[model samples]
Target: MVEQFQNHITPDSQWSTYEANVQSYRGLSMSAQSLYLAVGAILLGLGDKVPFFTVFVLAMVTTWYVFFPVIFARTAVVDFHKFNFGERFSKDGALRTAREDSKLSERAYANVLGGRRLRANVASNIDMPPGQNFRTMRQTRLKLDVFIPASMTVVWCIFAVYFAVFK
Candidate 1:
């Protein structure tokens, strides 16, 4: 499989398919980070008027909104750091980057450009598996499912608590 990947990735044309994901990394990461962090801050701010439980519930809901996209963004970063550039994503599935030492099955890779072969480029140039979009309308739309309830959970918890107790 590794050999197959090397063969597939050797072509420069396939590399073009991944150009958007690779080039757009900054915007995608920034957008997701901004959306969740900003919304998280807003959720936290609304906490004061609501009950402690409500705040806690909001925090939990906030976790969902803040969590998955972060996982996606962070994974993209880590995945890219170990990015084989045109190769399929890491088979290991962890954030592990390419080895600096020529030890994986006695195979070693080093940057001819970076002087001192001991220093490796590691996992920073991973490409999105072909036919996949790192950032897309569908993925963005899915946020509605999370934010809808994640946001509503906060509102519902607030109103429920208010009418049940604060009323």
Candidate 2:
């Protein structure tokens, strides 16, 4: 069992998979935003030819259809990476090696583990909250992933209502 676990710790093994997922997450996120903008521009260019309600429905549908799947996929990738990293880090020898090699500081290790089960060395000075101090990378990406599509959908809905009632 120990040998099997050690085999996965090599640079080309689990780390590579984590790196690939990070790349995929980035690509999917960028593609979602780009496609959203492109579709919005195309729909907006139609001007008065398209009915407001139709435009709104199309925009909402397109945003949700394109983005929600990407969001789901990214979430899955994140969850997998998180689980994999946590499992690897939990090994006694691995943790000791990481500390001795200065590969990861205590705070960084805690943050990557989502601030859970923090060691004494980490828990003292980094007193923000669980998942709060860990917001270095994921915070902005998650915000953009979820909010942009939702806000755009709301904008379309508002435009549709304004045209229906006022115009």
Candidate 3:
């Protein structure tokens, strides 16, 4: 049993490690957006003097084409997942109209009937061991909201200084 548990720690699973990495990457990607925007804005502010017309155009294109869809799609997917199927598919709802019903996994049905578990399953997959505690893990996790914006502010200030000095 000890060896079996040890194997779970290695990066070999189909879901757990992959999902954990995916979640981490998502957090990092979201955090990078503000920093990218700040850099773009600073570059735009100094574009003419720096003779960086290409960077200016690229930034403009990214702002319109790339930024909106990324943010919107991410928000929509998260919100859609949070919708309750039972409420959304009741007597007055979509499933009733369709004349077909969806089935839930036995475990999932049990979870719903029994009550939703308060603590999230952070293990990403069942093969791996469950984590310590959500509150502790959450507190320790890199909070992108606070630090990402703070770091972006410092970066923007530094870039503004450079733009002024080099101009």
Whose lDDT is greatest here?
A: 2
Residue range with the least summed lDDT across 10 consecutive positions in model 1: 102-111
Can you write out model 3's per-residue Cα lDDT over 1-167, one digit (the tens) per residue?
A: 22234344443342354345435555655545555665557665755535343443444344335533343333322222233233233222223235545422222322322312311231121133465432212332334323543454455456556655775
TM-score of 1: 0.28
Score residue 38 of candidate 3 by CA lDDT: 58
TM-score of each: 0.28, 0.43, 0.31
Could you tell which candidate, 2 or 3, scores higher by lDDT? 2
Q: Candidate 3: which stretches are off by over 4 Å?
A: 1-50, 85-98, 101-167
Which candidate should be chosen as best, given TM-score against the real structure? Answer: 2
Clashes of 1: 7
Name the runs in model 1 displaced over 4 angstroms.
1-3, 6-10, 48-117, 120-167
Q: For model 2, how does the per-residue alpha-carbon lDDT over 1-167 read when each residue is reduced to its tens digit?
A: 22235455553365456456556665665565566546545655555435544545655665567545544444443443444434434422133334453332223343333433443233233346666653323666566656766676666666566555655
- From the highest TM-score down, the ranking of the candidates is 2, 3, 1
Model 1: pairs clashing at backbone N, Cα or C within 3 Å: 80-123, 80-124, 81-123, 81-124, 82-123, 82-124, 83-126
